[model samples]
Target: MIDAANTYEALFVPALFQQWAPMVADAAKIESGDRVLDIACGTGVLAREAARRTGRSDRVAALDPNAGMLAVARSLAPGIDWQDGAAEALPFPDRSFDVVVCQFGLMFFSDRDKAVREMLRVMVPGGRCAVAVWDAIENAPAFAALVGLLDHVAGRPAGDALRAPFALGERQVLATLFKGAGANSINLTTCKGAARFSNMREFVEAELRGWLPVMGVVLPEPQIDRILAEAETILARYVTADGLAFDISAHLATCRRP
Candidate 1:
Protein backbone atom coordinates (compact mmCIF):
# COMPACT_ATOMS: atom_id res chain seq x y z
CA MET A 1 0.00 0.00 0.00
CA ILE A 2 1.43 3.30 -1.02
CA ASP A 3 1.12 5.72 1.87
CA ALA A 4 -1.21 8.57 1.03
CA ALA A 5 0.92 11.06 2.94
CA ASN A 6 3.99 10.09 0.95
CA THR A 7 2.05 10.39 -2.28
CA TYR A 8 0.70 13.76 -1.15
CA GLU A 9 4.18 15.02 -0.48
CA ALA A 10 5.59 13.60 -3.70
CA LEU A 11 2.79 14.55 -6.09
CA PHE A 12 0.47 17.14 -4.57
CA VAL A 13 3.07 19.23 -2.80
CA PRO A 14 5.24 19.93 -5.82
CA ALA A 15 2.28 20.19 -8.17
CA LEU A 16 0.21 22.55 -6.06
CA PHE A 17 0.93 23.21 -2.37
CA GLN A 18 4.67 23.92 -2.37
CA GLN A 19 4.39 27.27 -4.12
CA TRP A 20 2.06 28.70 -1.48
CA ALA A 21 4.34 28.00 1.49
CA PRO A 22 6.40 31.12 0.96
CA MET A 23 3.29 33.26 0.51
CA VAL A 24 1.74 32.06 3.76
CA ALA A 25 5.04 32.37 5.63
CA ASP A 26 5.47 35.88 4.35
CA ALA A 27 1.91 36.78 5.21
CA ALA A 28 2.59 35.86 8.83
CA LYS A 29 5.92 37.73 8.81
CA ILE A 30 7.89 34.85 10.34
CA GLU A 31 11.22 36.10 11.73
CA SER A 32 14.34 34.53 13.19
CA GLY A 33 14.07 33.24 16.78
CA ASP A 34 10.24 33.42 16.62
CA ARG A 35 8.40 30.28 17.55
CA VAL A 36 6.07 29.09 14.80
CA LEU A 37 3.34 26.49 14.49
CA ASP A 38 1.85 25.07 11.31
CA ILE A 39 -1.63 23.68 11.94
CA ALA A 40 -2.80 20.81 9.75
CA CYS A 41 0.70 20.66 8.44
CA GLY A 42 0.31 18.01 5.77
CA THR A 43 3.87 16.91 4.97
CA GLY A 44 5.03 20.22 6.55
CA VAL A 45 5.77 22.25 3.42
CA LEU A 46 4.87 25.50 5.13
CA ALA A 47 6.37 24.27 8.39
CA ARG A 48 9.70 23.66 6.67
CA GLU A 49 9.55 27.16 5.22
CA ALA A 50 8.82 28.48 8.70
CA ALA A 51 11.87 26.65 10.02
CA ARG A 52 13.95 28.24 7.28
CA ARG A 53 12.72 31.74 8.04
CA THR A 54 13.04 31.35 11.82
CA GLY A 55 16.62 30.07 11.39
CA ARG A 56 16.10 27.30 13.97
CA SER A 57 14.20 24.07 13.60
CA ASP A 58 13.67 23.86 17.38
CA ARG A 59 11.53 26.97 17.25
CA VAL A 60 9.13 25.51 14.65
CA ALA A 61 6.43 22.96 15.43
CA ALA A 62 3.93 21.26 13.13
CA LEU A 63 0.70 19.50 14.04
CA ASP A 64 -1.61 17.26 12.05
CA PRO A 65 -4.38 14.84 12.93
CA ASN A 66 -3.01 12.17 10.61
CA ALA A 67 -0.08 10.31 12.09
CA GLY A 68 1.10 9.13 8.66
CA MET A 69 1.41 12.73 7.55
CA LEU A 70 3.30 13.58 10.71
CA ALA A 71 5.62 10.64 10.12
CA VAL A 72 6.52 11.94 6.69
CA ALA A 73 6.94 15.46 8.03
CA ARG A 74 9.22 14.24 10.80
CA SER A 75 11.36 12.28 8.39
CA LEU A 76 11.75 15.31 6.15
CA ALA A 77 12.60 17.73 8.94
CA PRO A 78 13.71 15.83 12.01
CA GLY A 79 14.74 18.91 13.92
CA ILE A 80 11.29 20.50 14.11
CA ASP A 81 8.77 19.23 16.66
CA TRP A 82 5.96 17.28 15.04
CA GLN A 83 2.74 16.70 16.99
CA ASP A 84 -0.38 14.72 16.26
CA GLY A 85 -3.45 16.91 16.80
CA ALA A 86 -6.38 18.59 15.14
CA ALA A 87 -7.13 22.20 14.43
CA GLU A 88 -10.19 22.44 16.71
CA ALA A 89 -8.14 21.43 19.75
CA LEU A 90 -4.46 22.24 19.55
CA PRO A 91 -2.15 20.64 22.11
CA PHE A 92 0.06 23.44 23.31
CA PRO A 93 0.36 25.99 26.06
CA ASP A 94 -1.45 29.25 25.55
CA ARG A 95 0.64 31.96 23.93
CA SER A 96 3.25 29.42 22.82
CA PHE A 97 4.00 30.78 19.38
CA ASP A 98 4.92 34.10 17.86
CA VAL A 99 3.52 33.17 14.46
CA VAL A 100 1.05 30.52 13.27
CA VAL A 101 0.47 29.48 9.67
CA CYS A 102 -1.76 26.98 7.93
CA GLN A 103 -1.31 26.52 4.21
CA PHE A 104 -4.33 25.27 2.27
CA GLY A 105 -5.83 23.74 5.40
CA LEU A 106 -8.52 25.97 6.81
CA MET A 107 -11.27 24.73 4.52
CA PHE A 108 -11.34 21.10 5.68
CA PHE A 109 -11.30 21.84 9.41
CA SER A 110 -14.24 20.17 11.18
CA ASP A 111 -15.18 23.25 13.14
CA ARG A 112 -13.70 26.15 11.23
CA ASP A 113 -14.67 28.80 13.78
CA LYS A 114 -13.42 26.82 16.74
CA ALA A 115 -10.25 26.02 14.82
CA VAL A 116 -9.61 29.71 14.26
CA ARG A 117 -10.31 30.34 17.93
CA GLU A 118 -7.84 27.64 18.85
CA MET A 119 -5.25 29.22 16.58
CA LEU A 120 -5.79 32.53 18.32
CA ARG A 121 -5.75 30.83 21.71
CA VAL A 122 -2.22 29.52 21.20
CA MET A 123 -0.68 32.76 20.00
CA VAL A 124 0.87 35.49 22.11
CA PRO A 125 -0.95 38.80 22.17
CA GLY A 126 -0.13 40.52 18.88
CA GLY A 127 1.17 37.26 17.44
CA ARG A 128 0.49 36.75 13.75
CA CYS A 129 -1.68 34.05 12.14
CA ALA A 130 -1.91 33.40 8.44
CA VAL A 131 -4.05 30.79 6.71
CA ALA A 132 -4.23 29.85 3.04
CA VAL A 133 -7.27 28.29 1.35
CA TRP A 134 -8.01 27.66 -2.29
CA ASP A 135 -10.12 30.19 -4.09
CA ALA A 136 -13.59 29.18 -5.33
CA ILE A 137 -13.90 26.19 -7.63
CA GLU A 138 -14.88 28.46 -10.49
CA ASN A 139 -11.60 30.36 -10.30
CA ALA A 140 -9.60 27.22 -10.99
CA PRO A 141 -10.97 25.94 -14.26
CA ALA A 142 -9.07 22.66 -14.26
CA PHE A 143 -10.36 21.66 -10.83
CA ALA A 144 -13.84 22.84 -11.69
CA ALA A 145 -13.82 20.52 -14.71
CA LEU A 146 -12.41 17.68 -12.64
CA VAL A 147 -15.13 18.08 -10.04
CA GLY A 148 -17.76 17.89 -12.71
CA LEU A 149 -16.11 14.81 -14.20
CA LEU A 150 -15.90 13.13 -10.82
CA ASP A 151 -19.53 13.91 -10.13
CA HIS A 152 -20.46 12.33 -13.42
CA VAL A 153 -18.25 9.24 -13.14
CA ALA A 154 -17.45 8.55 -9.48
CA GLY A 155 -20.59 10.06 -7.90
CA ARG A 156 -21.19 12.84 -5.39
CA PRO A 157 -18.99 11.65 -2.56
CA ALA A 158 -15.92 11.54 -4.74
CA GLY A 159 -16.67 14.89 -6.25
CA ASP A 160 -17.49 16.43 -2.89
CA ALA A 161 -14.19 15.23 -1.50
CA LEU A 162 -12.43 17.26 -4.16
CA ARG A 163 -14.83 20.15 -3.68
CA ALA A 164 -14.48 20.32 0.10
CA PRO A 165 -11.20 22.21 -0.13
CA PHE A 166 -12.92 25.14 -1.76
CA ALA A 167 -15.85 25.39 0.66
CA LEU A 168 -14.40 28.42 2.47
CA GLY A 169 -13.25 30.23 -0.67
CA GLU A 170 -15.52 33.21 -0.36
CA ARG A 171 -13.75 36.34 0.89
CA GLN A 172 -16.59 37.64 3.05
CA VAL A 173 -17.22 34.23 4.60
CA LEU A 174 -13.52 33.85 5.47
CA ALA A 175 -13.31 37.33 6.98
CA THR A 176 -16.46 36.67 8.98
CA LEU A 177 -15.04 33.36 10.22
CA PHE A 178 -11.99 35.10 11.71
CA LYS A 179 -14.13 37.90 13.11
CA GLY A 180 -16.42 35.38 14.78
CA ALA A 181 -13.37 33.68 16.18
CA GLY A 182 -12.45 37.04 17.79
CA ALA A 183 -9.23 37.60 15.86
CA ASN A 184 -8.19 41.24 15.59
CA SER A 185 -7.17 43.27 12.53
CA ILE A 186 -8.14 40.54 10.05
CA ASN A 187 -7.10 40.93 6.41
CA LEU A 188 -7.69 38.71 3.39
CA THR A 189 -5.71 38.71 0.15
CA THR A 190 -6.08 36.58 -2.97
CA CYS A 191 -2.78 35.26 -4.25
CA LYS A 192 -2.43 33.76 -7.70
CA GLY A 193 -0.31 30.67 -8.33
CA ALA A 194 0.00 27.78 -10.75
CA ALA A 195 -0.37 24.03 -10.68
CA ARG A 196 2.13 22.17 -12.83
CA PHE A 197 2.09 18.47 -13.49
CA SER A 198 4.23 16.46 -15.85
CA ASN A 199 1.16 15.50 -17.81
CA MET A 200 -2.63 15.50 -17.70
CA ARG A 201 -2.70 11.89 -16.53
CA GLU A 202 -0.34 12.67 -13.68
CA PHE A 203 -2.54 15.58 -12.69
CA VAL A 204 -5.62 13.37 -12.49
CA GLU A 205 -3.73 10.54 -10.87
CA ALA A 206 -2.40 12.76 -8.12
CA GLU A 207 -5.92 13.54 -6.95
CA LEU A 208 -7.17 10.01 -7.45
CA ARG A 209 -4.31 8.28 -5.65
CA GLY A 210 -3.16 11.01 -3.28
CA TRP A 211 -6.26 12.89 -2.10
CA LEU A 212 -9.56 11.00 -2.58
CA PRO A 213 -8.58 7.97 -0.55
CA VAL A 214 -7.89 10.19 2.44
CA MET A 215 -11.40 11.57 1.97
CA GLY A 216 -12.81 8.01 2.10
CA VAL A 217 -13.77 7.96 -1.54
CA VAL A 218 -11.84 5.37 -3.47
CA LEU A 219 -12.62 4.38 -7.02
CA PRO A 220 -11.81 1.03 -8.52
CA GLU A 221 -9.08 0.72 -11.13
CA PRO A 222 -11.53 0.65 -14.03
CA GLN A 223 -13.19 3.85 -12.93
CA ILE A 224 -9.80 5.40 -12.37
CA ASP A 225 -8.84 4.53 -15.95
CA ARG A 226 -12.09 5.98 -17.24
CA ILE A 227 -11.57 9.20 -15.31
CA LEU A 228 -8.05 9.50 -16.60
CA ALA A 229 -9.08 8.96 -20.19
CA GLU A 230 -11.80 11.57 -19.97
CA ALA A 231 -9.58 13.94 -18.06
CA GLU A 232 -7.04 14.03 -20.86
CA THR A 233 -9.76 15.38 -23.12
CA ILE A 234 -11.43 17.57 -20.50
CA LEU A 235 -8.20 19.12 -19.34
CA ALA A 236 -6.37 19.25 -22.69
CA ARG A 237 -6.11 23.01 -22.75
CA TYR A 238 -3.92 23.09 -19.68
CA VAL A 239 -1.18 21.08 -21.38
CA THR A 240 2.08 22.88 -22.02
CA ALA A 241 5.33 21.98 -23.78
CA ASP A 242 6.92 20.88 -20.52
CA GLY A 243 3.74 19.54 -18.98
CA LEU A 244 0.32 20.58 -17.81
CA ALA A 245 0.02 24.02 -16.32
CA PHE A 246 -2.94 25.97 -15.03
CA ASP A 247 -3.71 28.98 -12.91
CA ILE A 248 -4.46 28.35 -9.25
CA SER A 249 -5.35 30.90 -6.63
CA ALA A 250 -5.85 31.05 -2.88
CA HIS A 251 -7.12 33.40 -0.23
CA LEU A 252 -4.60 34.33 2.46
CA ALA A 253 -6.16 35.50 5.70
CA THR A 254 -3.86 37.27 8.14
CA CYS A 255 -4.62 38.62 11.59
CA ARG A 256 -3.26 39.15 15.08
CA ARG A 257 -4.20 37.95 18.54
CA PRO A 258 -5.51 40.84 20.62
Candidate 2:
Protein backbone atom coordinates (compact mmCIF):
# COMPACT_ATOMS: atom_id res chain seq x y z
CA MET A 1 0.00 0.00 0.00
CA ILE A 2 1.12 3.61 -0.59
CA ASP A 3 2.14 5.77 2.37
CA ALA A 4 3.56 8.96 0.94
CA ALA A 5 1.47 12.13 1.21
CA ASN A 6 1.53 12.95 -2.49
CA THR A 7 0.35 9.56 -3.68
CA TYR A 8 -2.61 9.58 -1.30
CA GLU A 9 -3.41 13.18 -2.12
CA ALA A 10 -3.21 12.70 -5.87
CA LEU A 11 -5.05 9.39 -6.17
CA PHE A 12 -7.09 8.25 -3.18
CA VAL A 13 -8.57 11.61 -2.29
CA PRO A 14 -10.03 12.27 -5.72
CA ALA A 15 -11.17 8.71 -6.18
CA LEU A 16 -13.24 8.40 -3.04
CA PHE A 17 -13.49 11.59 -0.99
CA GLN A 18 -13.10 14.73 -3.10
CA GLN A 19 -16.50 14.32 -4.68
CA TRP A 20 -18.25 14.07 -1.32
CA ALA A 21 -16.54 16.62 0.92
CA PRO A 22 -18.34 19.63 -0.47
CA MET A 23 -21.67 17.92 -0.09
CA VAL A 24 -20.98 17.42 3.60
CA ALA A 25 -19.75 20.99 4.00
CA ASP A 26 -22.80 22.44 2.32
CA ALA A 27 -25.10 20.51 4.63
CA ALA A 28 -23.28 21.96 7.62
CA LYS A 29 -24.32 25.43 6.43
CA ILE A 30 -20.95 26.81 7.34
CA GLU A 31 -20.82 30.58 7.14
CA SER A 32 -18.24 33.33 7.45
CA GLY A 33 -16.72 33.54 10.96
CA ASP A 34 -18.16 30.20 11.91
CA ARG A 35 -15.87 27.99 13.91
CA VAL A 36 -16.09 24.56 12.31
CA LEU A 37 -14.76 21.22 13.42
CA ASP A 38 -14.46 18.17 11.18
CA ILE A 39 -14.39 15.03 13.30
CA ALA A 40 -12.48 12.12 11.79
CA CYS A 41 -11.31 14.49 9.16
CA GLY A 42 -9.24 12.00 7.16
CA THR A 43 -7.38 14.21 4.73
CA GLY A 44 -9.15 17.38 5.96
CA VAL A 45 -11.27 17.73 2.84
CA LEU A 46 -14.36 18.91 4.71
CA ALA A 47 -12.26 21.00 7.09
CA ARG A 48 -10.52 22.75 4.21
CA GLU A 49 -13.84 23.53 2.61
CA ALA A 50 -15.10 24.93 5.92
CA ALA A 51 -12.00 27.12 6.14
CA ARG A 52 -12.59 28.39 2.65
CA ARG A 53 -16.17 29.30 3.49
CA THR A 54 -15.13 31.10 6.65
CA GLY A 55 -12.37 33.04 4.86
CA ARG A 56 -9.93 32.02 7.63
CA SER A 57 -8.10 28.88 8.52
CA ASP A 58 -7.96 29.35 12.29
CA ARG A 59 -11.70 29.10 12.49
CA VAL A 60 -11.63 25.60 11.06
CA ALA A 61 -10.31 22.65 13.04
CA ALA A 62 -9.94 18.94 12.20
CA LEU A 63 -9.52 15.95 14.50
CA ASP A 64 -8.63 12.33 13.82
CA PRO A 65 -7.06 9.39 15.64
CA ASN A 66 -4.71 8.28 12.88
CA ALA A 67 -1.37 10.10 12.87
CA GLY A 68 -0.81 9.14 9.28
CA MET A 69 -4.12 10.70 8.29
CA LEU A 70 -3.47 13.80 10.43
CA ALA A 71 0.02 14.06 8.98
CA VAL A 72 -1.31 14.06 5.45
CA ALA A 73 -4.06 16.50 6.47
CA ARG A 74 -1.59 18.86 8.10
CA SER A 75 0.75 18.88 5.13
CA LEU A 76 -2.02 19.67 2.68
CA ALA A 77 -3.87 22.25 4.81
CA PRO A 78 -1.30 23.62 7.18
CA GLY A 79 -3.24 26.80 7.81
CA ILE A 80 -6.03 25.03 9.73
CA ASP A 81 -5.90 23.62 13.24
CA TRP A 82 -5.30 19.88 13.00
CA GLN A 83 -5.46 17.93 16.23
CA ASP A 84 -4.56 14.31 16.78
CA GLY A 85 -7.57 12.89 18.61
CA ALA A 86 -10.51 10.50 18.52
CA ALA A 87 -14.21 11.16 18.06
CA GLU A 88 -15.33 9.79 21.45
CA ALA A 89 -12.89 11.89 23.44
CA LEU A 90 -12.58 15.15 21.58
CA PRO A 91 -9.95 17.49 23.01
CA PHE A 92 -11.91 20.67 22.84
CA PRO A 93 -14.10 22.77 25.11
CA ASP A 94 -17.86 22.61 25.08
CA ARG A 95 -19.65 25.01 22.74
CA SER A 96 -16.37 25.53 20.96
CA PHE A 97 -17.66 25.33 17.44
CA ASP A 98 -20.37 26.84 15.30
CA VAL A 99 -20.66 23.79 13.10
CA VAL A 100 -19.67 20.13 13.47
CA VAL A 101 -19.37 17.93 10.40
CA CYS A 102 -18.20 14.40 9.96
CA GLN A 103 -17.85 12.74 6.56
CA PHE A 104 -18.19 8.95 6.55
CA GLY A 105 -16.74 8.88 10.05
CA LEU A 106 -19.56 8.22 12.51
CA MET A 107 -19.68 4.49 11.89
CA PHE A 108 -16.01 3.99 12.72
CA PHE A 109 -16.12 5.60 16.16
CA SER A 110 -15.66 3.23 19.07
CA ASP A 111 -18.68 4.77 20.77
CA ARG A 112 -20.90 6.51 18.27
CA ASP A 113 -23.32 7.75 20.93
CA LYS A 114 -20.55 9.31 22.96
CA ALA A 115 -19.13 10.81 19.82
CA VAL A 116 -22.50 12.28 18.88
CA ARG A 117 -22.88 13.81 22.33
CA GLU A 118 -19.42 15.28 22.07
CA MET A 119 -20.27 16.83 18.75
CA LEU A 120 -23.39 18.40 20.21
CA ARG A 121 -21.42 19.60 23.23
CA VAL A 122 -18.99 21.45 21.03
CA MET A 123 -21.58 23.26 18.96
CA VAL A 124 -23.46 26.40 19.92
CA PRO A 125 -27.21 26.38 20.26
CA GLY A 126 -28.94 26.78 16.91
CA GLY A 127 -25.69 25.87 15.14
CA ARG A 128 -25.61 23.04 12.59
CA CYS A 129 -24.09 19.59 12.57
CA ALA A 130 -23.87 17.50 9.45
CA VAL A 131 -22.79 13.90 9.29
CA ALA A 132 -22.36 11.51 6.40
CA VAL A 133 -22.22 7.75 6.58
CA TRP A 134 -22.03 5.19 3.83
CA ASP A 135 -25.17 3.19 3.14
CA ALA A 136 -25.14 -0.60 3.45
CA ILE A 137 -22.22 -2.30 1.70
CA GLU A 138 -24.61 -3.98 -0.70
CA ASN A 139 -25.70 -0.60 -2.07
CA ALA A 140 -22.16 0.09 -3.17
CA PRO A 141 -21.56 -2.81 -5.51
CA ALA A 142 -17.84 -2.13 -6.02
CA PHE A 143 -17.16 -2.20 -2.28
CA ALA A 144 -19.38 -5.23 -1.87
CA ALA A 145 -17.24 -7.05 -4.42
CA LEU A 146 -14.03 -5.90 -2.77
CA VAL A 147 -15.07 -6.94 0.71
CA GLY A 148 -16.41 -10.25 -0.50
CA LEU A 149 -13.05 -10.90 -2.12
CA LEU A 150 -11.22 -9.95 1.08
CA ASP A 151 -13.31 -12.40 3.05
CA HIS A 152 -12.81 -15.15 0.50
CA VAL A 153 -9.04 -14.68 0.69
CA ALA A 154 -8.24 -13.75 4.30
CA GLY A 155 -11.14 -14.87 6.47
CA ARG A 156 -12.37 -11.48 7.79
CA PRO A 157 -9.82 -8.91 8.93
CA ALA A 158 -10.17 -6.53 6.00
CA GLY A 159 -13.78 -7.23 5.25
CA ASP A 160 -14.89 -6.35 8.76
CA ALA A 161 -13.73 -2.74 8.55
CA LEU A 162 -15.14 -2.37 5.07
CA ARG A 163 -18.49 -3.33 6.56
CA ALA A 164 -18.13 -1.21 9.71
CA PRO A 165 -18.21 2.06 7.77
CA PHE A 166 -21.73 1.29 6.72
CA ALA A 167 -23.09 0.05 10.00
CA LEU A 168 -25.20 3.05 11.07
CA GLY A 169 -27.11 3.31 7.82
CA GLU A 170 -30.62 2.81 9.13
CA ARG A 171 -32.59 6.07 9.11
CA GLN A 172 -34.65 5.53 12.26
CA VAL A 173 -31.62 4.44 14.25
CA LEU A 174 -29.49 7.37 13.10
CA ALA A 175 -32.23 9.85 13.81
CA THR A 176 -32.78 8.39 17.27
CA LEU A 177 -29.10 8.84 18.08
CA PHE A 178 -29.10 12.47 16.95
CA LYS A 179 -32.23 13.25 18.88
CA GLY A 180 -30.84 11.58 21.97
CA ALA A 181 -27.71 13.69 21.60
CA GLY A 182 -29.93 16.79 22.08
CA ALA A 183 -30.16 17.71 18.44
CA ASN A 184 -33.56 18.76 17.13
CA SER A 185 -35.05 18.99 13.70
CA ILE A 186 -32.83 16.21 12.52
CA ASN A 187 -33.03 15.67 8.78
CA LEU A 188 -31.72 12.45 7.32
CA THR A 189 -31.27 12.33 3.59
CA THR A 190 -29.99 9.52 1.43
CA CYS A 191 -27.78 10.42 -1.51
CA LYS A 192 -26.71 8.25 -4.40
CA GLY A 193 -23.55 9.26 -6.25
CA ALA A 194 -20.99 7.90 -8.61
CA ALA A 195 -17.70 6.53 -7.30
CA ARG A 196 -15.10 6.84 -10.03
CA PHE A 197 -11.59 5.52 -10.26
CA SER A 198 -9.21 6.50 -13.01
CA ASN A 199 -9.16 2.86 -14.07
CA MET A 200 -9.59 -0.59 -12.63
CA ARG A 201 -5.86 -1.03 -12.01
CA GLU A 202 -5.48 2.34 -10.33
CA PHE A 203 -8.53 1.56 -8.24
CA VAL A 204 -6.95 -1.67 -7.06
CA GLU A 205 -3.61 0.07 -6.47
CA ALA A 206 -5.21 2.86 -4.45
CA GLU A 207 -7.09 0.41 -2.25
CA LEU A 208 -3.93 -1.63 -1.72
CA ARG A 209 -1.92 1.48 -0.82
CA GLY A 210 -4.38 3.90 0.73
CA TRP A 211 -7.21 1.93 2.29
CA LEU A 212 -6.16 0.84 5.77
CA PRO A 213 -8.46 -2.15 5.91
CA VAL A 214 -7.01 -3.53 2.71
CA MET A 215 -3.37 -2.78 3.55
CA GLY A 216 -3.63 -4.12 7.09
CA VAL A 217 -4.10 -7.61 5.70
CA VAL A 218 -0.57 -9.02 5.40
CA LEU A 219 -0.50 -11.58 2.63
CA PRO A 220 2.38 -12.85 0.50
CA GLU A 221 2.87 -11.29 -2.94
CA PRO A 222 1.56 -14.29 -4.83
CA GLN A 223 -1.44 -14.58 -2.57
CA ILE A 224 -2.09 -10.89 -2.91
CA ASP A 225 -1.79 -11.14 -6.67
CA ARG A 226 -4.26 -13.97 -6.70
CA ILE A 227 -6.69 -11.95 -4.61
CA LEU A 228 -6.30 -8.98 -6.94
CA ALA A 229 -6.89 -11.10 -10.02
CA GLU A 230 -10.04 -12.47 -8.46
CA ALA A 231 -11.18 -8.97 -7.48
CA GLU A 232 -10.60 -7.75 -11.04
CA THR A 233 -13.34 -9.92 -12.46
CA ILE A 234 -15.75 -9.06 -9.66
CA LEU A 235 -15.23 -5.33 -10.24
CA ALA A 236 -15.05 -5.63 -14.03
CA ARG A 237 -18.69 -4.73 -14.46
CA TYR A 238 -17.97 -1.19 -13.20
CA VAL A 239 -14.99 -0.54 -15.45
CA THR A 240 -15.16 1.48 -18.64
CA ALA A 241 -12.56 2.95 -21.01
CA ASP A 242 -12.56 6.16 -18.96
CA GLY A 243 -12.19 4.31 -15.70
CA LEU A 244 -14.25 2.52 -13.08
CA ALA A 245 -17.63 4.17 -12.64
CA PHE A 246 -20.33 2.93 -10.35
CA ASP A 247 -23.16 4.21 -8.17
CA ILE A 248 -22.47 4.48 -4.46
CA SER A 249 -24.87 5.53 -1.73
CA ALA A 250 -24.53 7.54 1.48
CA HIS A 251 -26.82 9.04 4.10
CA LEU A 252 -26.32 12.66 5.10
CA ALA A 253 -28.00 13.80 8.29
CA THR A 254 -28.21 17.45 9.27
CA CYS A 255 -29.48 18.75 12.58
CA ARG A 256 -29.62 21.87 14.71
CA ARG A 257 -28.19 21.99 18.21
CA PRO A 258 -30.79 22.55 20.91
Q: List CA RMSD, all candidates.
A: 1.0, 1.8
Q: What is the TM-score of each candidate against the true structure?
A: 0.98, 0.94
List candidate 2 stretches off by more than 4 Å.
1-7, 213-215
Candidate 2 lDDT over 1-258, as tens digits, reads: 226445656776787788888898888888999999999888788888899999999999999877777788888889999998999998999899999999988987888889999999888888899999988787887888888887887668767756777798788889899988888889999988787888887776566555643235555567568777887789989988888988988999999888
lDDT (tens digit, per residue) of candidate 1 on 1-72: 239889989999998998899999889999999999999998899999999999999999999888778889
- Pairs with backbone N, CA or C atoms under 3 Å apart (clashes), candidate 2: 1-209, 2-209
Pairs of residues at least 3 apart in sequence or in different chains that clash in candidate 1? none
Q: Would you give me the overall lDDT of model 2?
A: 0.83
TM-score for candidate 1, residues paired by index: 0.98
User: What's the distance in Å from true for residue 102, model 2?
Assistant: 0.4
